[model samples]
Target: MLLMLLGTLGVVMSAAGWLSYRAGLQEAGEMFDARLVQSTRVLVSLVDEPLSELNAYPGEPIVLRGWHGEAQGVGEALAFDDGHAYENKLAFQVWDTKQRLLLRSDSAPTTPLAVAEPGFSDVVIEGARWRTFTLRSSNGRWFQSAELADIRQELATDIAGGTLLPLLLALPLMALVIWWSVALATRSLRGLSMEIGQRHPERLVPLDPADVPREAQGLVSAINGLLQRLDVALARERNFVADAAHELRTPISALKVHADNARHAIDEQDRVQSQELLGISIERVERLASQLLSLSRAESLGGARAHSRLDLDALVRTEMEELRPLAERKNQEIQLTLEGAQLWGDEFALGLLVRNLIENALRYTPAGGVIEVRTSSTGTHAVLTVEDSGPGIPEDERERVFDRFYRRLGGGSDGSGLGLAIAAEAVTAHGGRIHLGGAARLGGLVARVELPLDT
Candidate 1:
């Protein structure tokens, strides 16, 4: 659009310049014609007195012939009885009523002047331009005056040259005005971009109409409408999680009590069988309770707040202490390694993340296997890793394990399959990431978490 506007302006300016040039030339021609006609009239008056005296005396043919002789010399001699003849460069000619040339100026062409209606005329002789004016007197005498047409052409050229400087000076000033208007027009858009770019991701604020242009009002309204919808959807998801957890807790608690009652049978054989059933039921209830809590936390904790500074190494050590007895019951050694790392995260949420990873490692590892928990720092981030000496998860199932209720194929774990999902939600809430990879010392699954060093 700017190019098109400049192009249109260029064309209009060019046309105006051309018209001005032609008009100047035409004006020069008109002034030259007027001057030529005035000079012709003056020259006619000069010769009229002499010719009238010769005509006043009839039969004095000798006087007329002598006057004619003087006129022939006058064209070349630049002499006048009144001492008023041109001194420099003017052309003159005298002719009879029969169109016979009586005398000619020294600079006049050898050919006859092309006279038309006894008025101004433009004629060419010997490839040179001339402006000629003819006058017929009351006597049988004619006068003609001519000047070079180069004078008019020179005047036109001078006028065009004089106009150039102003035209050149105007260009930059015109460009500045155009640029200023364009910048003013786009100021609203720049403000809009800055306002949107500086906002927090969780901030669903609507754009202000007063700061937006009329043309962009519809787009701002649409974006505000979308943010409202997302807020409603997120609210609904949180409510569903809270409702599901409340509903599932009672049934799980009742099942655990009934399983305990069954295990207290009087018969020894029945008691042994019922104890196995009670153990299975207890594991199932634990899995259900853990999954429900994870789902509720994942749904409720959107990216509403930033993390707080805490010692990540101390957090990992505390969680390992609680899991040590479970690892020992399976004849597995749980090792906790601390590197004195500090991280910014929610303490309670991060504790849940460490517990889930350790439990996941314990579930996959066989008896007598080793599980390692490590915490360290890397430049601007803190890292936590949990690995076990068991069959490692395949690459294809790594991402799926982070989804709700997504258990790996051929995996044997008494879990509700929400451990990794819950851990992922907590890490994401703290602006951190969690991934499953090959362990360095253990041939099993390695779960690593990295969180920012600053809140």
Candidate 2:
């Protein structure tokens, strides 16, 4: 992160410096042009009369010697009161209307500096380029000032260098500050990672959010929420495993006893009786396993209900058809009033819900009893009711029947007590409700499930 910040800052600073350098050079060039014009006007006013008296020395032009050469140090001339080092790079000339050189500086060439015109111009002499400005006075004497083009360029470069030097020196210090700031900001996150890394497998405690940065608070909150959900899922799994172990033990023991009895029986009649008992034990175990699976499937659909359109009446009919044999074996009559009610739900989950309710009714009702299956819909809700002519649950114990592994004592039904719980699970997952009450028509338990048609 620090490297990224420094890299981005470096790129921005480089572009800014380039623009500043170009602007400085351009501004310096304009100032140099103005300086040439202003110096020409001032010198022509001051020196016109003095140099006129020296017209006798026409070719000699009152030469003023500056620095000799590059042999002297730059500050040596200024310190010793000679002349500035740059004086030799500057020169001036005067020309009369006939283009004759009336007077000139020593550094200037003996030939005419430029064409006899006004304003600024560039000229080359002895392979060295010079920038010259020409001014025509009122008296018609042409005053011209010239400077080395290389000197103007060198000064512009120096000015630009001076302007950007401070920033270059401060860049390293800025990078250090940025690195420190980023490290400080991420210190809490690093600590959180270490805390999670060293935790025990079963330790799903949430991290403290007090020290978290505002920017990372959401991340921490999401992680905590995930941990909370994982904790619940793990606890549920553990309970399921424990309950399965306990529930399977009795039937398996009975199967072993019955098998042993059948194997040890001396007579054919005794063996046949033991085998029948063994078969009953096997069926009970199968029923328990199937109910456990249904409960699991229903619970797992909590947040993952499918969004398929299905007819509630049709779905209930399908479930009822599968369980018709159980109702027939008991000589129970099934009276179904299925309307064409449409619903949006998980087809498999709704099947589980309907099957459990109808099967419970079929199992608990007396032989030759009446079971009524009905489906209907209000404007916003679809409802399914399975009522049977069996002893209904007492109002005080009505809610407990939905608990996992719960049963009303003395109910003589071979139920695993998971049927109504599975029904409840599916109904709750669909954002719906189920009620257990005495059926007024059938005079028994009524398992009525209500679901939203658009859920």
Candidate 3:
């Protein structure tokens, strides 16, 4: 940014300098032309009578007296100590109507100073260019005054140089000022970087936006948002660890107690009962670990790659196939009604969501109960619903069931209390919503999921 600003400034300054030089040259040219016209008028007034008395034939030339600028007689009093070196460059001539050069200055050319046309003109005499101005007097005499072109050009160059010198000399100072301003403007960014760098890893506090320039406000806002998310994710991870430790501690203790019981059993029947208790304890630990892993995976889905487009109906049908064996073991009938629903989402996560819902229903439903899974699509949304013959959740408890490690009281089911929580996270990751209510047709619990068709 600094380089670009400097480069632009340099180009603008250079163009301005060029324009100033041209304007100076033009003004100098106008002034020199005016001098030429004034000199012609003055010489015509002085030489008109002298040329009339001269006995010259037509087209004849005669020389008149001219000044050398040396101190002589009365000219000594008029001469200045510092006279211009260009005084000798001026010349004049007088001519008759017949194109006869009757009178001319010593410095002037022997030939006519210029063409007979009246007005300013450029003429070359003896290899030297001259700026000449001519006028016709009332007595029919042609008066001409001229100056060397080199003198006028030198004056124009001096004027233009006078105008451009200071600007050229100050360019370095201007560059220094621009560099200082750019550094001062970027100081705030450096400070912000320093502030962030000095922070500890655990310090996920937001930076003060007011302390930054307005140009940096959006960047600061984005960083603050990231810090907030990091704080939330860190808090959740801590809670998950604490909850896992707490949940595992009870089952681990039970397993230890069962091991001791089996070792101290007085009879074979007592030892067999202890072994069964130990098995139950081990199953509880396994279930807890699986639920924890599922919950962790669901939470991470948001940061993973985008989900792919899939047929929701087909995925659910495949999940039902996998869960059918468990349903048959419980003597529960499973039914699927699909209508070619489609949506964008992680297939594995969606399958897990369906499995959890069905597994929950299977654990709680009585023998000979019926479970129904349905998939269909509207114009804007893809819908999935699982209805089971198990007891329905109360309206007041339905919302709370999605909370982590939450379970209904007196549910009489051996669950890790994380299935609904995992399902809720997975649905949220897919930008979908889930609802719980009594199944109108099944007369039991229903889990309904609605996801955008184009998500």
Candidate 4:
């Protein structure tokens, strides 16, 4: 903005200076012309020859027959006492209508004056410019007057120089004024920076718009909007931590009581039953703790984690290997059918996603049922499939499966039901989508995850 102002000021100042200089030159020219005309009139009245005699001879020297018809010698010049001494200094010559040289001023050039039509004329004599004027007298004599052209040129130069000097001098002052205005305009921005710098790290309060510049109001409003969102997010995290701790305490306490009872039992049969009950209670507590941690991690992962290229086929195989023992304990087998496919995702989050899906399938499948994992790439998407030979979820309950702690009706499993929810959250964090349906090959649940091939 300052540069633009300076450019505009320069154009205006240059134009104004040029116009003022032109006007000054023109006025000086007009004043010089008026003085030249006045001098010509005074010189014309001094010729004293008759109209007929003046026109008779065309190229002869008519010796000055003075005002009393006396023979005046060449040095005995007629002195017209016009108070202006500069006019006396002017070179002039007089001629008759017949073109005879009647009289000449002592200052006139030695060469005879060139005859021209009566008016203003320019002539070069001795390599210098001269302004000349010719006037015909009532007695048929011709009066010619000339002034040096250098005088008018000098006057014009002086007038233009005088007018332009002040403007040139004021240019620095104008620049200073522009600088001060710009400094005042940007003062609000400096104040805002100082205010922000002094703020505490925990203080997320909105800035005052009243003190901000109108042009920067939108920026301040956007900052305030971001602060409001952060405040809400912090508040939500606090509530989630409090609720999760409160919910887990009860199961943990139950597990502790059952373990203490199992340790005190005496008889073999009673001890076996007590041990089994304690084992189940402990498993329940473990499931609760795992679910709470997964849910908390999922909520926090929202686009904050860095992602990298991962081999989906290798990841699925690893997850299947880890779950193979659990499947064997139930008289079930885990199978993997994967293609060499790569995906971009957070490694830890994708591992959590695959682990939860496989665990969900294992917990719901019957003793003799099998769980299969598969990974393949299609066009720009990487796909992962986990299928189990178990009762499939109904179409209506499929959407609800991703809700935290939402267990299915008639589902027989000592699980926290948060596995699918964790899988959904992790998939979303990687810019992926998850779908649940009946598996065509296994006639059971199928969980498919599709993610963009590029990050």
Candidate 5:
């Protein structure tokens, strides 16, 4: 940015300096022309009276008044106590109508300064160009004033240089100022970078946006949003680890106890009983591990898995079919009503969502209990509901049931208490909502999930 700004400044300054120089040159040329015309008029005013009384002698040489030498003489001396170097650059001459030179200055060329035309003109004498102004008096006498073109050009160039020199000398200072201004403008960005870089790796808190420039406000907001999400994900991961450790302790201890009982049992029947108990403990551990994995997946779904469009009805049917044997083993009746529900969501996450709801229903419902699963869409939302013929959650505890590892007082003793929590996370990741209440028909717990079809 600094380099670009400096480059632009340099270009503009150069263009301005060139234009200023051109203007100066033009102004100087006009002043020089005006001086020439004024000098010619002054000569006509001063010489007309003097020349009219003088009679021109034919074939007689014209003698200049100021110098002792004749008008045609070369190498003649003219002395002044304090003469300027520019004196030789100006010259004047007077001529009669018959074209005889009446008077001349030392610097004037022997020939006429210009043609008999009565205005300003350019002429060359002795290989040097001159600007000349010719004027005719009322007596038909002519007066002319001329200056060397080289001297005029030199003066014009000096004027243009005077106009451009200051800018040329200040180029370095202007570039420095531009560089400093660019640095000052971008100091906020640098501060933001430094603030981020100096933070601890575990610190995922947002940066302050108040002092940020308007152009970078959106960028800072986006970064703060990402930081908030990272903080959430990190907190979830830490909680999952802690919860998994806590949940693993009971089943693992149970398995250890059963293993110890089987090892110390004297009777074969006692050993068989211990082995059975150990198998049950192993199953609980496996179920807890699976539930923990599902919780992690749901929490991690976030924004990354929200792209795929899935059929809620199809996913619900598939999960129900897979869990059918589990229901049949308990002599439970599983009723499914799929109503062509479609929504935008991750297929895998939505499948998990459906499985968790139905599995929770199957776990809590007693033997011979009826579990009703439904999938339907209402234009803007795809809804999935699982109702069970089990003890319903209390209204006060319904919201807390979605908390990680939270369970009701009389909930299933062997459960990991993560099914509803995982289901809730999945719904949230898809920008949906969940509600828990008593089923109108089943007279038990009802877990209703409303997922947006538009996403």
Candidate 6:
């Protein structure tokens, strides 16, 4: 930041210096030109008496000598107000109508200072530059005043340097001021960084916005929101792990008991019975473990799923085909009114969602009950429904059924109670909605799901 500020200042100052130099040079030129004109008028008036009687004067024109003294400092040029040190640098000449040199100063060249043209002009004499101004008089003679060019240039350069020196000297100080201001402005940001770095992993508390500057309030707010979400996800994960441990302990203990019974049985029939019970316990534990894994996978399905365009009705038909034999063995009829609904979602998540709803229906409905499944669209959403003509859930328990490990008291099914929870998570991952309500004309629980359309 300091470098950038300093660089910008340097460029502006350089441009200002150049412009000042040009202005100084132009102003000095005008002032000197005016002095040349005044000097010409004075010399022309003074030369009247000398040219009136040309024959009275000698063969050469008389010269007005100037002081030739040692150079000094400060007021050296105009000391004592008698004459200037630069008097030798200022020269004048007068000429008659025949171009004869009538009068000249000691420093004036014997040759004509410039062409007979009236007004200002430049000339080179003895490899040195001079500025000359000529004027026509009523007597038909001409007067020319001249001065050295280098003197005027030196004064102009001095004026420009004097104007620009202070600004250049202040550049470092300006850089210091800019750096201090930037540091003061960012102090709060540094503090915020330190606070975040010092946080404990379990410390998901939000940062206070009161101390933050208005310019950075939005950033602080976003960070706080992230911390809040992380806290929620962590709490949920803890609860899931605790519940899974608790649920697995009972089945594992039963498996161990049956294994011991089978190992110590005396008779062959007793050993076989014990082995059968052991197999049942093992199956129960396996199913419980599988349900816990599904629940874990469902909870993590928000961001890591591969999504695709899927036919909702087609996925429903596939699950029905897989479960049709189970429904047939129970003497139950599986009814489907598939209307070919198209949706965009994760294929695995949506397939699981479909299968869970249908299987729950098959498990809960009595023998020979009707399982009604339907798929349709509402322009922006594709809808799915699986309903069974069985004892529907109580109105009070309908919402709780979607919670992990929740089951109705007398539902007559030995489910691990994660199927509905898994279905709920899959619907949420797809930005969909699901609800359990009474079926139309069937008087049983209806699980209706709605998802965004593919378009």
Candidate 6: misplaced stretches above 4 Å?
Answer: 56-63, 67-80, 86-129, 134-143, 148-152, 244-310, 318-332, 340-349, 366-369, 378-381, 429-432, 452-455
At residue 367, candidate 5 shows an lDDT of 85
Candidate 3 colliding pairs: none
- Tens digits of lDDT, candidate 5, 1-455: 76776678778777776776677667777998899888888888887897677675546435443323223211233333445446677888888888988777878877899998899898889998988998998999888889898765666566666667787788788878888887887899999999999999799888998888999999999999999988887887887898899989988999999999999999999999999999999999998899888888877877554667777777877888899998998999988888888877888788888898888888889889999988888889888888999988989999898887787777765677888888888888888899998888889998888888878
- Give the winner by lDDT: 6
Positional deviation of residue 100's Cα in model 3 after best superposition, in angstroms: 7.2
lDDT of each: 0.74, 0.86, 0.84, 0.77, 0.83, 0.87
Per-residue lDDT over 226-312 for candidate 3, one digit per residue giving the tens place of the 0 to 100 score:
999999999999999998888889889999999999999999999999999999999889988988998998997864545589988
Alpha carbon lDDT at 298, candidate 4: 81
For model 2, how big is the CA root-mean-square deviation? 3.1
Better of 1 and 3 by lDDT: 3
lDDT of 4 at 421: 80
Model 6 TM-score (2 dp)? 0.78
Choose the strongest candidate by TM-score.
2
What lDDT tens digits, residue by residue, belong to model 2 across residues 281-364? 999999999989888888878666678999988898888889999988999999999887888999888999989889999999
Off by over 4 Å in 4: 1-211, 214-222, 263-268, 305-307
lDDT tens digits by residue: candidate 6, 1-455: 76888898999988888888888889989999999999988877777765786666568987888877776654554554566778888899988888988888999999999999899999999998999999989898889999999878777777877777988888778888889988887888889999999999999999988878899999999999999989988998999999898888988899999899999999999999999999988988897887688777777886544557898878988888998987998999888999989987787788889988998899899999999999999999999989899999998999999988888899988777888998999888878899899887788989999888852
Ten contiguous residues minimizing lDDT sum, candidate 1: 60-69
The reply for model 1, stretches above 4 Å from the true place, is 1-267
Candidate 2 regions exceeding 4 Å error are 46-63, 69-80, 95-103, 109-116, 122-129, 137-143, 150-156
Q: Point out the worst 10-residue segment of candidate 3 by lDDT.
A: 67-76
RMSD values, in order shown: 18.2, 3.1, 6.2, 11.1, 6.5, 4.5
